[model samples]
Target: MVLGTSFHFDGQGTATAADAMKRYCGLLGEQEMEGKSSPQWLATKELVKDDGEMVFEEGISRFCPNCAKILKSAVEGTYPRLI
Candidate 1:
């Protein structure tokens, strides 16, 4: 499992967050496949206010072909997007 360093963001980090999560999912998915397991990934981000109180928390996961297609479609534009 890979642990990401803490990053602080406010109103202007949507792209940064998306990039980070994308990279994390890619790496984790590759690792899972390498280990002969069903490719999968789990990601969590904690959002807090300046006072450090938890404002929001989210967890995301992807498995196998779904994960593979999502990333691939972004780059290759081959797969139809899910609605």
Candidate 2:
């Protein structure tokens, strides 16, 4: 299990708070898999630089809608989500 920090978004736009949260989580997952750096990772890199230390959990476990194809090919298990 990939353990990582979870993010929260303020409900201020047309999208629901949950939607925003999922979007960001997906972005983070993509960055991790690609070995690419993201704003979130960059900001926290010094504080917590080890990628192995982060584990995807709960909402973070789901694949990004945009990157679903790649994830489907590589990852196991059915993607779980909150209704």
Candidate 3:
């Protein structure tokens, strides 16, 4: 099951689901592109779960301080054991 808050459009025009996912996934596809920049958190490798999952910990980066705080709370709430 996926748990997420609403994706922020930052006042950009709304997109169809297909268009949104296409753009989102494209940002995660590869680093060092010509004109697009992915959020650092999206591009980082992460452990999938707490059950002996793969471990990858690059420093956590967020779009902003508020987002980092919110993410911390959500992650701690949902995966208490993983923290």
Candidate 4:
């Protein structure tokens, strides 16, 4: 049940999963090289009422005006979330 994915930098300027984990842990002030662990890294599995379906409601998914504009531009192929 992975909630999300992250990116990290390898020695060659590329992001890897292990590097991402280290960066994430470092953000929390936990020693990355000391073999320390954080509960936040653990994954939790849960059941949702709808299986493989998107539930949308009016005004429930509102975003900031600026963000919405940016997203719209992305949708139009003018902007990209990752560059």
Candidate 5:
């Protein structure tokens, strides 16, 4: 499915939060998140960066919207804020 609103990201940055979650889990678009966490993803959280490409991409979306903003910042190389 396509996004109705304009959205953008670069260098492996995903177009939406759900998309980010997919990348984080390394799951295919056809798959569900299955209410599970990725060990690989969790390990990355130990760093200030992820392969020098991203910061945390979705820190429990139900609780932290800042995660989305932080992902944008990580890609754009700027400071992020919660909102």
Candidate 6:
């Protein structure tokens, strides 16, 4: 399977899901939270429990820091024995 920084984006260098979220968040304005977790974290949890890889494939080939963090959590969560 493909690996590393190269898998981070498409030929046009766009991360559709993350980009869309950026725009969407911009329109929505800043959300002030003292300690609330990000929406991405919530979604990542669900994804890891479900079909996280497929979701990951559709977006950037590269894992953003958040994605990478959540993915590592998911992988470890899914396969404790391996860890």
lDDT of 4 by residue, 1-83 (tens): 21122232335453433444344333323322223222211111101212201111111122222233322332344532221
lDDT of each: 0.33, 0.37, 0.31, 0.26, 0.36, 0.36
Residue-level lDDT for 27 in candidate 5: 38
Q: What shift in Å separates residue 25 of candidate 6 from its native position after superposition?
A: 11
Model 4 worst lDDT window (10 residues) = 51-60
Badly placed stretches (over 4 Å) of model 2 are 1-13, 32-36, 39-83
Worst 10-residue stretch by lDDT in candidate 3? 51-60
Off by over 4 Å in 5: 1-55, 80-83
lDDT, candidate 1, 1-83, per-residue tens: 22233434444453333345454445534534323322221211221233111111121232223454433333343533222
| Error of model 3, residue 21, in angstroms | 0.5
- The runs of at least 3 residues in candidate 4 whose Cα sits more than 4 Å from the true structure, single-residue gaps closed, are 1-61, 80-83
CA shift of 18, model 2, Å: 0.7
By lDDT rank, best first, the candidates go: 2, 6, 5, 1, 3, 4
- Per-residue alpha-carbon lDDT of candidate 2 for residues 1-83, written as tens digits (9 for 90 to 100): 32233323335443433454456555654544224344334233311323312322222344344443323433332333212
Q: Residue 53 CA error for candidate 1 (Å)? A: 14
Q: What is the model-wide C-alpha lDDT for candidate 2?
A: 0.37
lDDT score for residue 51 of model 1? 19
In model 1, where do residues sit more than 4 Å from their true spots? 1-15, 32-83
Q: Considering lDDT, which of the candidate structures 1 and 5 is the better prediction for this target? A: 5
TM-score, structure 5 vs. true:
0.23
